[model samples]
Target: MVAITDKEFKQLTEYIKVNYGIHLKEEKLMLLTGRLQKVLQQEGFNNFTDYYHHILNDQTGQAVVTLVDKITTNHTFFMREADHFYFFRDRVLPFLANTVQDKDLRIWCAASSTGEEPYTLAMVIDEFFGKDKVFWDTKLLATDISSQVLDIAKKGIYSNEKIAPLPKHWKTNYFKKHDNENSVLIDKIRNEVIYRKFNLMDTTLPFKKKFYTIFCRNVMIYFDYKTKIELVNRLYHHMEYGGYLFIGHSESLTKEFTKFKYIMPAIYRKE
Candidate 1:
């Protein structure tokens, strides 16, 4: 493997931070090299510096997309953090059921990697609304930075083992088992989620309507303090008043940084 030089590391890390809001620290050099070395080799580059220049000079932006996809971790599973789903179903959905006057529920799953989180969310919403779902616009907008993952999500297919954590009823109702034992999300449930490629580092959000709930989850762990704070504030502007924000349990916001009121560990409400 071609070892990344100090200058190459700095350039790559800075580029990632600026474009993606991901903070790659000095200790992550090995991790970066491990993830990117194969990319460099596949692209016929001999070193990280050459690879960086190629990425900079690539006109289609596909190089950077490939870089981000390879460097960032997309490790997520159905019901990975189960408590947030409980809160969404038991508490947040009830409140929204009463409060959202238009019967249009806008939910954003900001970092939906490979469909697990948003698909799980769709199941919860389906169960919550039951037969009344047709009256409400409960479709979820699930976005992620990587087009690779978004493509996988759009397919709505997964191995049965990957979805084993889902409730039995949900498994039976929302999915169809393939002959190979892989489960494909039923069309009704799959169509309810709109997947898009979104870069969180964009200075302004493009949504015309505010969301009632946003599930950003574990992705923010890669961001630094300033990026996280700024991103949270941006999300605040894009949410409806009293809307809920469900982050990863390991992530937190200090009182000084955000206007969101803490509802529980990893859960906040817009005031």
Candidate 2:
């Protein structure tokens, strides 16, 4: 393995936290080294400092992309959080469908790791709207910082294990066999989600229209309290009044740092 010195680890962690909002602690030194050792070996870089310099000096941005991909974990599956989807379908969708007169539903899966969450949302929307779905604009925006995961999300294929948590009807309605061991989401469901490579740390969020619901789940645990609060505030401004935000169940937001009304354990409203 390529050994990273204390100085090198600090340099890399600071760069990541400043640019990507991911706070790496000293304990993650081994993990960081393990994940990047092969990349360093292949690139002919003997030390983390040289690799860091290469990343900084690379104008194409691919180095940074690869670094982020290596350091981040993108493990997700269909209907990973069942209750949130239930609430979205039963409570959130009904409210939006009734209140929004324009018939345009804007939804964003902000940390869409490998496409399961957004696709699940699309399926829920389709099932809820049923035949009337043709009349509304329900296309979803799914974003992730890692291009590698975004590419996997775009393909919309999953193994049987990944697809297991979904409802049976969903299996029949939304997916088709990819081979003996996997299935791919039908284009109808796949097309409903638009994937983009987005870093939540960007100072300015680029969106012309505010979203009704944003699912930024499970990724914020990497950020420190300050970064988390700042991102929460940014998301608040990008959402419509009375919009809902669903974060990871393991995460929480206190009233002291954010204005979002706590609706439940992991859900908030921009009321």
Model 1 spans with C-alpha error above 4 angstroms? none
Error at 157, model 2, angstroms: 0.8
Residue-by-residue lDDT tens digits, candidate 1, 91-184: 9999999999999899999999999999999999999999999999999999999999999999999999998888888888888986587989
For each candidate, the alpha-carbon lDDT, in order, equals: 0.93, 0.93
RMSD of each: 0.9, 0.7
Please give the TM-score that candidate 2 achieves against the real structure. Answer: 0.99
lDDT of 2 at 175: 96
Error of 1 at 90 (Å): 1.0
